[model samples]
Structures are given as structure tokens and as C-alpha cells.
Target: MLKRIGYTAGGFVLIGVLAVAILWGLSVGTVQFSLSQIFNIVMDQFSSPLAIDDPLNGPEQTIIWLLRMPRLLMAAIIGAGLAVSGVIMQAIVKNPLADPYILGISSGASLGATVAILFGIGVMFGENFVGIMAFIGAMAISFGVLFISNLGGRPNSVKLILGGLALSAVCSSFSSFVVYLADDKEGIQTITYWLMGSFAGAKWDMLPFIAVVVLVSIIFFWSQSRILNMMLLGDEVAITLGRDLHTYRQVYLIISSLIIGFVVYAAGMIGFVGLLIPHLVRMTIGTNHWTLIPFSALGGSIFLVIADGLCRCIIPHAELPIGILISLIGAPTFVYMLVRKNYGFGGE
Candidate 1:
């Protein structure tokens, strides 16, 4: 009872923090807006969705509604998706180091987006062609990993990881080769920026799709908490208990891949949230997926919102790639956690 009450209180606290961070995020960037002004604008917009003129200044409305809101929302959504993906992957592979990219999703998406940018494939999809191709590439590589891992024998955690790493290398090498052969300086720069990851491309049109995918995936995984618990118990133990985990693992992988595909398409390759957030939540709470999943989602959302805010204001008159900032912050924090023996990779 106490634990449940504590978790509920923590959830409320996180939601409050997320709200403040969203408002703070709106106030960040080149031109600053106050929280009260932002509040009024949001309330006014909600009250009158079709109003041509908002109470805030023209530029303020544009920055808050058109720019910062979508980006901040995307940061939260992407963070939650990646963190949930991390939790699922860790359970599927039964490995502490497993992350969203463990199945080569990011590399495949990068390859697809690169090809679309350089070769002009999938242009019929309109402005989102690159994202479309990225989604396709991510799914393709995910299935490829599954197939390759099963080639030798029954696919296990080690085999799956090896297969994914091998395919990731292949996709990366091909992507580099394409870039090298193209020799388009501008396109090369675009690819570099895309790989580094930014929420600058967030648009209102894309938000609905991203929101639906992430939210649905989170709910679905939460519903499967029992199976997830079983997965972490090892295949032999799971089978001894009259439950086969192989099929369920594959299904979970496909679902995770779909979540990651949309995220990569929406926000490029933001890293470490997947690698870091789940472990942080696991350290605080126990390994129960029911508790770990929701906390990780909320914690990850908060983490990314703050990260995006820092990225906007860290330098003078410029924004850094969110991916770079995450690495910069996450690497040191992860090291500290690694050195601290209190939380021994869910063994505590």
C-alpha cells in the first residue's frame, strides 16, 4: 500500500514537473516569451481555435504555437517512445545494455533517409518522403535482424544482438558510400544534421501520428507486463514454467520496431534516452515492468524536455543538436551509475 501510494505521488509530481518544463520550454529560444503570456495565448487559442488574432503579439504567437509547442511536444513524445522501447528491448533480450537501437532501427532509418535525400526516392510522399522511407528502412532492417538471427539455430539474445550489429554496419557503410559518391556538399551537410538529431522539423501535421503511435505502444507494453516479467527470467526458466517466450519476443520486437520507426522518422536519431532512462527508473523502483514502464515514460519525457531546453540556451544565439546534448549529459551520468554498486543491473 505504501509503495503504491508513493508511486502515485511520484506520478503526480512528474506530471507537475512536465507541465512546468513545457511552459519553460515555450519561453526558451532566440526570442523569449513570459510564462503568463504563454498561458494566456494557450488558453485563448483553446477557447477560440479559429481566431485570426491572438492576444499575444504576432511573433510571440508564431514562436509559441508554431515553433516551440510542437518541438517540445515531440521531445516529450520521442523521449517516452525511446524509453519504452528501451524497456521492451531490455526485457526481450534479457540484457541490461539493450536499447532501442539494438535491432539496427536507427541505422536503417538513417540509411533510408539518406537515400531519399540523395537519390530522390519516395518523393511522391511529399514533404515527408524522407520520413516515409526511414520508416520503411527501419522495419526492413528489423525483420532482417530477426531472419539473420534465426539462420543458425533458435535465435537467442546474443545472436539477435550480433545480427543487428552486423546489419547496422552494413547499412552504415552503404550510407557512407552513397554520400561519398554523391559529392553534393549541401546534401552531405543535411545528412550530417539529420544524423545528429533535431526537433526543429516538428510540425503540427506530424504530431497526431507521433502521438498515436507512442501512446498506443506504451499502453500495449504496459498491458503485457506479465509476459515481460517472464522474458527477463531466461528462456529455460520460462519454458520450464510451461510458457514459451520465443513467439512473444518476436511480437514485442516488431511492436518496438514500429514505435522506433515512427520516432526516427519524426525526430531523427536521438540516442541514450533509451539506454539511460529505463535503468534510472529501474534503479529507483524495482524491476516490476508495471512500475518501471510508466515511471520510465514520464521520467524520459521530463528528461528530454529539459535536455531540449538546455540545447536551446546552452550556446549563444544557436541551438545544438539534441542528440549531441543527450550524449554529453547521459554519458557521464551513466558512468556514475555504473560505478555505484547499489543498483546492480536489476540485481538489487
Candidate 2:
């Protein structure tokens, strides 16, 4: 009972931190707003309808509602999604080093985005053709990994990892080849920026779809915590208990792939959140998925919001790519975790 109460209290604390992060994120861009002003704008926007000439519909409202809100929300969603994906991927592979992109999704998405940006290959898909192609490529590579791993026999973690590495190499080579052959400096710069990841393009119109997909996936995984725990004990143990983990592994992979695909589509290639957030949460709370999943989600949301806010203000009149900042911070933190004698996967 004490442990459960502590978890609940920790959860509330995380939510509070997330709320403060969101408010700070909304306030700290090129045009700063006081917390009180931000509060009034949000309340006014929600509490009453806007008239064309209403003072509330002026620049502050535009900045708060039309610009910053969606971007922050996107950050939260992507953070939660990636963190949860990490937990799932680690469990699936029974490896502490596993990440959401372990299935070659990142390489495949980069290849697709490279092609779309450099050659206009998927212009027919609409204004967001690049994102569309990325999603398709990620899914394709996930399926390819599954197929390759299953080629000789029933797939195991070793087979899955090998297959993913092979396909990732292939996709990366193709992306590089295309970039080298194109010789388009502008397109090259665009591809580089996209790969670094940002939520600058987030719009309210896009939020509903992405939010629904990510939220539903997180909930679904939480519901399968028992199976995830079983996976950690290995397939032999699972079978001895009258459950075959083969199908569950495949389903979880597919679901994780979908989460990652949308994340890449919405925010390009933010890294480290998937690889770092789960480890942080696991260290703090232990690895019972029931608590780990929700804590990681909230922790991730808070981390990304603060990171994004820092990215916006770290440079004068310029915003940093979120992916670069995360990599910079996550790498050192991860290394420290590794060197610590007390740290162990799933709390040992």
C-alpha cells in the first residue's frame, strides 16, 4: 500500500511538472509572455468565443493558440510515444540496449524522406508527401525485418536484431547514394534538418490524428504488461507456461512500428527519447510495466517540453533542432548510467 501510494504521488508530481513545462514552453519563444498572460490567453480562448475585433483575438492569442500550443502538444505526444516504444522494444528483445528504432524504422524513414525531399518522389501524396513516404518506408522496413528474421525458422531475438541491422544498412546506403548522386545542396540541407527533428511544423489540424494513434497504442501496451513480463523470462519459459510468445512478439513489433512511424512522420527523427527515457524510468521505479509505462510516458512528456523550450531560447533569433540537443544530453547521461555500479537492467 505504501508503494502504491508513492507511485500515485510520483505520478501527480510528474503531471505537475509536465504542466509547468508546457506553460514555460509556450512562454519562452522569440516573443516572450509572462505566465499570467499565458494563463489569461489560454483561459480566454477556451472560456469564450472570439470575435473578429475582440482584443483576445490579437497577436497574443495567435501566438498562444495558433503557434505554440500545437508544437508543445506534439512534443508531449511524441515524447510519450517514443518512451513507451522504448519500453516495449526492450521487453520484446529482452535487451537493455534495444530502442524503438531497433527494427530499422529510422533508416527506412530517412531513406524515404531523402527520396521525397531530393526528388519529389511522393508529391502525389499531398502537401505532406515527405511524411507519408516516411511512414510507408518505416512500415515496409518493419515488415521486411519480420520476413527476414522468419526466413530460416521461427524468429528469435538474435534473428530479429540481425535482420534489422542488415536492412538498416541497406536503407542507409541507398539514402547516402541518392544524396551523393542528386548533388542538390538545398535538398541536402533540407534532408539534414529533417533528420535532426523538430516540431516546428506542428499544427492543430494534425494533432487529433497523431494524438489518437499514440494514446491508443500506449493504452494497448499497458494492457499487455503481463505478456511483456513473460517475454523477459524468454520464449522457453513462456512456452513451458502454455503460452507461445511468437505471435505476441510479432504483434507488439507491429504496434511499436506504427507508433514510431507516426512519430517520424510528425516530428522527423528525434532520437534518444526512446533509448533514454525508459532507462531513466526503470531506474527510478523498477520495471513492472504497470508503473513503468505510465511513469515513462509522463517523464518523457516533461523532458521533451523542457528540451524544446531550451532549444527555442538557446540561440538568439534561432531554434535548435530537438534531436541534436537530446543526443547531446542523452549520450552523456546514458554513459553515466552505464558506468554506475548500482544501475542494472530491469532493476536486476
lDDT of each: 0.89, 0.92
How does candidate 2 fare on TM-score?
0.97
- Model 2 Cα lDDT, one tens digit per residue, 1-348: 999999999999999999989999999979999999999988987898575456647898988888899999999999999999999999988888889998799999999999999999999999999999999999999999999988989998888899999999999999999999999999999999999999999998899999999999999999999999888899999999999999999999999999999999999998889888998888888989999899999988999999999999999899999999999999998898788876656566
lDDT of 2 at 185: 100
State in Å the error of residue 218, model 1. Answer: 0.5
Give Cα distance to truth, residue 126, candidate 1, Å: 0.9
The segments of candidate 1 whose C-alpha lies over 4 angstroms from its true place after superposition are 51-57, 342-344
Name every residue pair that clashes in candidate 2.
Answer: none
lDDT of 2: 0.92
Give the candidate number with the greatest lDDT. Answer: 2
Model 1, range 182-261, lDDT digits (tens) per residue? 98899989888988889999988789988998999999999999989988889999999999888888899999999999
Model 2, stretches more than 4 Å misplaced? 49-56
Cα error, candidate 2, residue 344 (Å): 3.6
TM-scores, all models, native as reference: 0.96, 0.97
